[model samples]
Every structure is written in structure tokens, then in C-alpha cells.
Target: MASSPLNEGLISFLATHAPNDAFAETDPVKASQTLFPSTTYTDAERAEISQWVITSSHVGSPSEDAAKSAERLSSLNTHLSSRTTVLGAKPSVADIALYQKLAPVVSNWSPEERTGEQGYHHIVRHVDFVQNSPLFGLKLADKVNIDVDNVIFKIKPIDAKAEKERKKKEKEAAAAASAAASGTATPTTLTGEPAPEGKKGKKEKAKGAAQAAGEAVASIATGKPTAAPEDAQTKKKEKKEKQPKPQKPAPVEKPLSPALIDLRVGHILKAERHPNADSLFVSTIACGDPAGTDNTSEYEGQVVRTVCSGLNGLVPLEEMQNRKIVAVCNLKPVTMRGIKSAAMVLAASPRVVEGEDSHKGPVELVNPPTDAKAGDRVYFEGWEGEPEAVLNPKKKIWESIQPGFTTTDSLEVGFDVEAVPQLSGEGADKKTGVGKLKTAAGLCTVTTLKGATVR
Candidate 1:
């Protein structure tokens, strides 16, 4: 009731008409409590007006709820009929408040265009009337003529010190250019072109001639040629090649530490099709917090997480319940089709191909060992670490390591590749290539299925 738009409109109207009245207050912070009195919705007109304040500048599309709100407003508009305002023969706050919300739409539509829409006729008329009314303090043409596309507003001023520093850089560049010209030096130029041959070039040539003359005289007096012009340029080229190329350090697998992954054995407590998404299944999984902390307030000690998985067509609904699976517990939560997924269930499937649903083949579950309990941590043989408190969804941590996630010919799940460990080798000496999945966690298996990738 406090958020009722009808009450808000009524307050605005009253405020304009009776500036001194207590109920006419308009300051948001001051009138918050008073604007929507307990009886705001008791009035039929106010309640109907409240329903019309549906859309806002922020909302782009009308959701299902928004559609219902529009319908409610239409019904009220029909009841108001030919009235200039929402409630009666006179303009009121309800008209002003509602006009503001629908102004964008109404001002854009022609009168005939408004009638073409089911509910716009009354709303457009109301907007036209409000803008013309004195209560708004402006005429309709003036108010509706705002140039939204050309809007301009002052931005924050630059910091004084920053402005000063920027000016200093400009002055320094100018001074340097002046000094280069005055010193007759062929200043270092960024264009990679020699400085224009002017006075500077003539000076340099004359200086070179004097040096050459001195060198020749000394060579003649010593009965030895000035050391043959050095092959300095050639030596430089050779030196560059001799400098060993910087070997690219082998790509280190910065996998989310096992601790960061919070991989735990979990049982699907229940599974159901998500109401809002056709390809997703909403499941309740039971897995303890990897950090081993009590999460009773949020998890309620049920050790349960709701996961939304795209397993609808591949995994049968009935087969999902009570199935033992591995869950990544530290991945950031995501809202899919309005359902908040708290964890992700790990599965193995053929590498995903764009625009192709792999559900056509077996999207197998990476199951937990038969004897493993729900809280048991899943770890690879050589890689040891814990799940980070929260996984960064945006960072490609999972994407970086996902290629390594693989199944052996025996259907074992692990990081199915190898390379010379980073610490064991140097630059070009480093070795890397395909290797075996190095996990000691007992393979999760189904008694009936064999030699299949767990996806």
C-alpha cells in the first residue's frame, strides 16, 4: 500500500493545490511515511490509479507481472470513461503521476495511434490534459517538446593538480621542441625519418670532415692506418642473433586448486524440470560445505544445494534422484531462468560443439565412488589444493582447465594429460605433451555402464 502509485499521484496533486496542508508534502524523505496513509488503498479511485503506474524508465520489457498490471489499469480506465482525470471531472494528482509514467509513450503516439492500442486512448488523453493544466506549471506543448536526444549536463571537474600536471607535460614537450631547434641537433624523431637536412646537417658534415682529417694525420704519423673502419653494424647484427631467444615459459596449468573447486561427492536428493526453462533440470543435491563450516542459516543443515543443469533430454527424470555425483561447490551462484543455482554438478560429455546439443549422445554423469560419502572431497593424484571461497565466474579459470578434464579408455575421470612439471625444467629444456590423467581418487562408476566418458 505504501508503494501504491495512486497514493503517490494523489499526494502530488494535493501538494500542488494546497501547499500549506500537512497531507500535501512532496519532499520524498519527509513525506515517505505520510504520503501513503493507511487508508490510501481504501479509496477506489486511488487504488485504480496505483495500478497504472506500472512501467518505469528503467524497465525495458513488461514481464508477466507487468502485463497483469497493464490489464488492471485498462479496466480502471474503462470505468473512468470520458473523465479528464482518473477519479472525476477535475484534474488531480492521479492524472499527473500517471501521465509522467506514460508520457514517453503517449507523447510519441498520434491521437488515432493511441486509439489503435487497447488502453492508450485514455492514458494519452490524460497526459495531454495534465501538461495543459496549471497544476503542472507548464503547457503540454512545452513540456512534451523536450529534446531528449540532445540532452546536456555538466560532468565532474578535473582535479586541479591533475590539470596542472597535464599542462606541465604540454609545456615540456613544447620546450623540448624549441631546444632541439636551437641546439642545431638532429633531434630524435618518432617518424623514423631523418630530421630535415637544414643547418643541422651542414654543421654535422663539417664536424665529421675535421674529425676525419685528424684521424688521417694521426694514421700517417704512426705509419699505421686508422684501425680499419669497424664492422660495428655487422657485429651488432651478429650479437643480436647470438643473444639466446627468450623461451616462452611453458604454460602452467593454473587450475582452481582442489580446495578452490570444492569438489565433493553429492547425491541428487530430488530432480524436476525447471518451470521456466525447457532444457534445464532443477535438482536438489546434498553435499557438505567444503570448508567444513556450518551453513545452517542458509543451507539449513540439509547440506543441500539447488543446481540447474541442462540435463533434461539426456538424463531421464526418474534416473536423476538418489544418484551419486561429483559437484563443484565453489563456483559462483548463477540465476538460470529465475532459479538460483547454488552449485554445479560435474558431468562428462563429448567436447561441446557450437549450435549442437550433445544430449543426442550420452551426457554421462561423473559419478562418485560407490563407497564415497556425500562430503568426501574429490582430488586428482598429483594436483592438491582446496576450493577458493568463491569462484570468479567471469575469469576463465574453469575454461582454462576444462580441456584437461577428460576420461580414460577405462572411463576414469581426471586431468587426462601431462607435461614435464614446471619446477623440474628450464627454458627450452621444458617438456610438455599429452599425458595420463593423474588422479588417485577411485573411479566413479555405475555397475551397468562401462568404457564411457562421464559427462
Candidate 2:
């Protein structure tokens, strides 16, 4: 109802992006419809966006307590820790309202106040992200300068698998304590039956058997022919022996994580159109394999993989030559047309909607940091678990995890854990987060595509 920077930013964005609409509108709830008019949202998202728009107005209000404002800021930071925008991966008018209010406040904060070990670092990151990210379409020339590398504290991301295990152990321990309190936790033997308390105990049974053995020995030594006792001993020994049981085949090992895919930084040595296949490109890539590796040969004295990617028409041939890239190195070798491909090049393309062609153009090859040498390890953050030497195709290990591969709003490649339902744990253990793909050098990224699928 009153003039404010938050309201102005929202109106200005609506005017620029949707100028045909009424720029004089003052109601934030009504103005939101014009910001992204074509972007239809679910009922839940509409409700959330409306709530956030109102919440944005309270951040710098004169009546708001400083403590309350700090608490709210902290909550926003935590919410954005695992997400690129307030609506997780989706953009909305809420982000613009929030950015207008906080960006100015963030610009005035000192280094210690913005990125100190105990500062609102995530909030600062979000502010910088909004302005630079193309999703918002804000290209201000005097944008606040942010140093992403000057992070004062690196927060360890929440580990969903470890958290799931911790909760399971707590639940089991609580059940055990409850059973003990009821006084019904029966003592049991190794075979899962109630222990015999009044019968011949283990010690007594052993003594009786020893006595029988000694008596038999005396009878034999004294030349007393005890036919019944000898026959009884024979029957007892026979009773203890039985046919060997068949061993159960070893349990099939489930693929534990995305780390099972052996991702590596690779440098292409040569690239050419496939002689037999019109849509494929054959590339010789150096991926740090040891000499004499199977399906590998020497190229310029470096062990290289013959990788065939279906990028002939998607990515230019010049871009594929002598460039650093990320690749899946552990897949089973498959012959493409007439050439054997030992690895698959990683790339990013827009997600295919229900009716759209999945193989249309605009695919971008994933670029590893320039300093990253061929064969350097690349993995999703918080998922640095060791990779399989050679992925088992029968298990479909790569297929199960590849769906989680995605590009961030900032063009960084990452893996969204919730996309893989099987690995996302059960009920309360369910999780959601994006682990950015990285090597020791830096993050893997695309040229310009945002929110695309990386495979």
C-alpha cells in the first residue's frame, strides 16, 4: 500500500518484461501475475509466492525488532542453502521482491558482517546470485561486487544418507528401551529359543557325555564287549552328521551412489565425423588411464580412450578438439557404428517436455576447469564416495543415478538427490539437495544454459 524499494523493483521488472500490463498497479499480489505471465504455477506455488511477497515487506520495517529481523534472515539463508531460488529450482516474483530489499542492505555490510565465520553468508550468496543469474534478467551495470572465493566459512552440507542412518538407529534404540521397560524382553539362545533354565544345563550335559565316553573306554580296555553301548555311540555320532546345505548365492550388491560413475576430466586429442554414422562424432580423449588399458591406444604417447558422442550436429567440431571436458569413464564399452567407444562425453541440454523432441539441437559440452588435467577425479559435492573401477551395466548403476544430473540457474552442473526416488530414503528420511559437480580445480559448467539436464 506504500511506496518502497521492494514494490518499485517488482513494478519495474513487470514493466520491463511485460510492458503491456498496467505499471501503475500498487497491489503486489496483483502485480505478480504480470512478472511472469506465461509461467503457470501449481496451486501450492501460487500460495507460497503470495506468502513470500508479504514476508518481504516486513524485513526492514520500522516496527520490526532487530532480533526478529536477524532470525528471519537466518531462516531464509538456511532455506536457500540447498536451493538456487526461494522456490527451490523455480523462479518467481518472490525472488525479485526479496532481492530489492536485501541487495541494498547487503551492499552496505562490511566484509566481517557479510562473510565472517558467523555471518549470513548464504544470504549474501543469494543476493549475488539473483543479479548475475540470467533467470532474473537483471543486468545492472553497478551491481554489488561479491567475491565467491572469499568465503569465510565453508559449511559442511547435510549428508542425507548419514542422517537417515542416525534416525534409524535412534528409532531402534527407543524400541529396545521400551521392550526392556515392559519386562518382556526374554533371554534367548543362539538359535532364537528361550534358554533352558531347569533342564540339563550346558555344563551338566558336557559332564554326562564325558562320563559315558570314559565308561565305554573302560569297557573296551577291560575286554568287556558292550555291543549295545558301542552301537548307541555309533548312532549318536551319526545323528550329529548331516548333508551339507547349499550356500545361498552372494547377495546382489545395490549401487550405493552417484559416485559409482567414474567421472574424470578429459582432454580431447582429436575429433572427426564418424565414417559410418552421420550423427556421431568420434573423439580420441586422454582421460588419465594407465598404459595398456583395454580398448585404449597411444595417441601422441598418451593413453587415450576412443569416445563416440552423438554431438556431431549438436556441438561444433572445433569446440570438441583439444578442449577439456567431463566424461563418464566407467561405462561398459559399446561399439558405435564401426568404432568402439570406451567412454561417454558429458553434455547439457534443455529438459525435454512431454511432446518436445528430446534430441533437438542446443546441446553444450560440459567444460572442466582449464587447469584440470586429463584423468583428474570429478564428483558431485557431498558425494565423493569412491567410483567403481568398471560400472556393472547389468545392475544399471549409471541409469539409476543419471536422472539426478542437472544444471543450476548459474550454469553450474550438479546432481539433485531427490530426482532418484530409489536412493531418496523413506518417509521422514526423504531428502532434497543439489551437489555441484567439481574437480580439485573448480566446478564443471556450461556456456549459458540454465536449469538444463546434464548427462
Candidate 3:
């Protein structure tokens, strides 16, 4: 059977994603379909594109607000998260149509904006896959510079059964909440406290006299009060005294070293300017915590933390792209510009000479070995030990040790024992050496700064 003539959007899509000898300049889509008939759709894949997801997506229309554009991009990101192409596993013309629309915008996205905290990760991944995959054979000169290894978030493979159940529960909860709000459905576990007025007193009644003192309930049951109150009081006091108090666990005393800082290799998935602060850039970073860890959240299946750093002006936003660096994960999470920052990214710059502005330019992130995976343990060479779970803010441990954090002439980060006297054991306990910051992969280094204090 003869197929219908290809639409204008499909013609343009073919020109970009799958251009070849099959395409006829006069009637490209029709000509391409005649030669490479695989472009044919069996009603399974829709052949539509011009009607943009957001009118602004096709071209950044001045009339469209930024919020709508963002909303559309977010929706597209989510849609592509599970599928390789717009038509699931199939390479359809729609994939190219999306690429044509999105390529320009993604090409311009700053690292902090794309993956910084899950902003447009799936979309970026989709674009990368469509552009490079052998199935597409798309040859575009102005391709987005994507480093697959420097991914912001590595989405874990989804468990079909678990996800299905989770979604089912979520839907049930939503429905229950809706019913309760409209005053239609009765109370449910999902609808926390919206029980019918008649059922309210049942909870108290079930407890009955048992909720009263056991002795009172016993006396009341028999309609007799012949127990001595003094005897009961003496027995209760005796039992209380005999029960041993829980022993307070002794505090874990770690040596005053960078090891207490809980440093680890972190990969910034995405970064963006903090909503509440101009000088702070908020980043979504993966540092290898298990799912549901405190102050940690899931992004693309990766357990990630929202980190706020003062690298907005000091470090170029473009450089913040999904890159590996050193991070202090055990520090107490703090709210920066209304965002809870779970980790601190370590960057280096020339030491501030007291009166100089510390927020000056040329800040470089501490570079972990390129082969180092996120969450790899990083510590000062000679100071290697099990790091504390979290640094105690009251101990001022981080503050005391930070002064000794310095970069050597060779660009390597190290802990100078002389800078922090507390770490320099004297006499028999004479511990003196510059411990370089490193992971099993290699030593961490900065770009140019040497003999500079690091924080």
C-alpha cells in the first residue's frame, strides 16, 4: 500500500538526523520513504512535530516566559528518562525533531544549569544518545561537548516490580487525599485524619480501663478497693532503682587531621546559581551514599547531595560541569540560600593576604584522578584512617585543621604538620610529615596555585 506524503516537520527532521542519498531535495520525506522505507510508521509511532511541546522550545520566542520553557524542558527530560528514543526503543523521526529543537539550547546550557541538581539530566542524556548512537547516524558538526564519563547523575536501572508498586501506592494516596478533600470518601491510612465523626471515640474506648492504672482497673473490675497504696509505691520505687540506667557510649576521639573531615571523591552532576544567594552556586553531586541517606536524595538512581559552594564568581560555571573533585561529606549539612547543602566541594585559589578579597577569580576545584569513581575515599597520604561519620561542629575540629590545608609547589594538596601544632606530636610521639591528599587512584592536584592555604 502507498503511504501518505510526509509532513513538513518530518522533511526537516530527515534533513538533520538522517540525511543521505535517499532524500530528494524536492520532496525529501516522500523520496526518503520511497528509498529507505523504514521511515514508515505503522500507526504505532506518531508522525507529528511542528506543534511544539512548548511554543518556545522550537525557537526561544520572546513572548514565552522562562518558567513555561523550563516546565516543558523538565517534562521532556522525564519523558526521555526511560526511553532511548521518543518512540521508546524505535528510532523514529520524532527523535530528530526533538534533537533539532533541543540541540541549540542544550549546547548553550552551563554545567551548573544542566545537571546541577537534576535540572535537565535526562534531556541531556537523550540528546547525547541520539546524536552519537550508530542507529541514528546523525552527522552534525556543532555537537554538544559531552563527556559521558563526567556524568552528573548515573541513573540506576529501575526495578519494574518495585516501581510499579510504588506508583500504585502513590496513586492510591493521591486519590484518597482528593476524596477526603471533597468530603466524599471515608477516612483511610492515606488520608491521615479525615475519619467520620462517628468513628472518633472508638480508639479511646478500645483502650478502656486498661489505660488507667493497672491496680485501679483491677479494683474497679471487682468493685473493691482493698489494696494498700503504700505497698504499691514501695514496690514501684524498688523496681525503678533496680533497673540499671543506660550507659552513655564513650565519644569517639579521632586524631586532629583531615581524616576527620570525611573527604571523598564527588562528581558534580549539575550546578546552578543559588536561588537565594548571588555568590553561592548550588550543585547536585554524587558522592556515593546509599539511597535514603540523611541530607541525601536520589537523582537518576544515584544517591546525591545538594551542595552550595561559593564558586559562582571564583570558578567559571562552565567548569562546574559533571567533573570529579574532592568533597567533605561528613560535615554537618547546612542551609545555604534556603537550600540544604549536604556536602562541601573543595576548590583552591591563591591564599588571601588577610586584607585581600578571598572571593577573587582563578579558583580551581581539587582534581581527583580521572579514573577515580565518585565516593572513593580521599584523605591526606600519611593521615589515612577511617574517617568520622560526621564532624562535630562543637569540637571545632574542621576549623582547627583547615589552616594546615595547603598546596605544595608541585601543585599537590597536602597537610603541613607545622601549620597545625595540634597534629605535630613532640618527643616520643614526634609525628611530622606533609601528607598529600589522595585516593587509591592518585594524588589530588590544583592548576597553578602553590604554597597557598586551602579550605
- The number of the candidate with the highest lDDT is 2
Determine which window of 10 residues in candidate 2 has minimal summed lDDT. 227-236
Candidate 2's displacement at residue 134, Å, is: 36
* lDDT tens readout by residue for model 1, 209-322: 344344444544454554322211112233444676899989554554333456778777789999999989998876743222222111212336789999898778998887
Q: Quick one: best TM-score, which candidate?
A: 3
Models sorted by lDDT, best on top:
2, 3, 1
Task: Supply candidate 2's per-residue lDDT for 262.
Answer: 94
Model 3 TM-score, all chains together: 0.49
Model 2, position 433, has a per-residue lDDT of 93
Cα shift from native, residue 333, model 3 (Å)? 0.6
Per model, state how many residue pairs clash.
16, 0, 6
Task: Identify the runs in model 3 with alpha carbons over 4 angstroms from their true place.
Answer: 1-242, 425-431
lDDT of each: 0.52, 0.74, 0.68
User: Model 3: per-residue lDDT, tens digit, 1-455?
Assistant: 22344456545656654755433433423443443343444442433322222232344333558987777777677666666555454454445657767777888888766777766787787778778654456777778887656656555645668778666655654664454444443332332333333443544422321222343434434556534322122222334447778999997676676777899999888898888898999899988675446787655445579999998878888889878879999889888767888889998777877888877857778989876877788988778778788888999988999988889999999998877878876788877778999987899999898987777
Q: In model 3, what is the error at residue 60, expressed in angstroms?
A: 43
The ten-residue window of minimal lDDT in model 1 covers 228-237
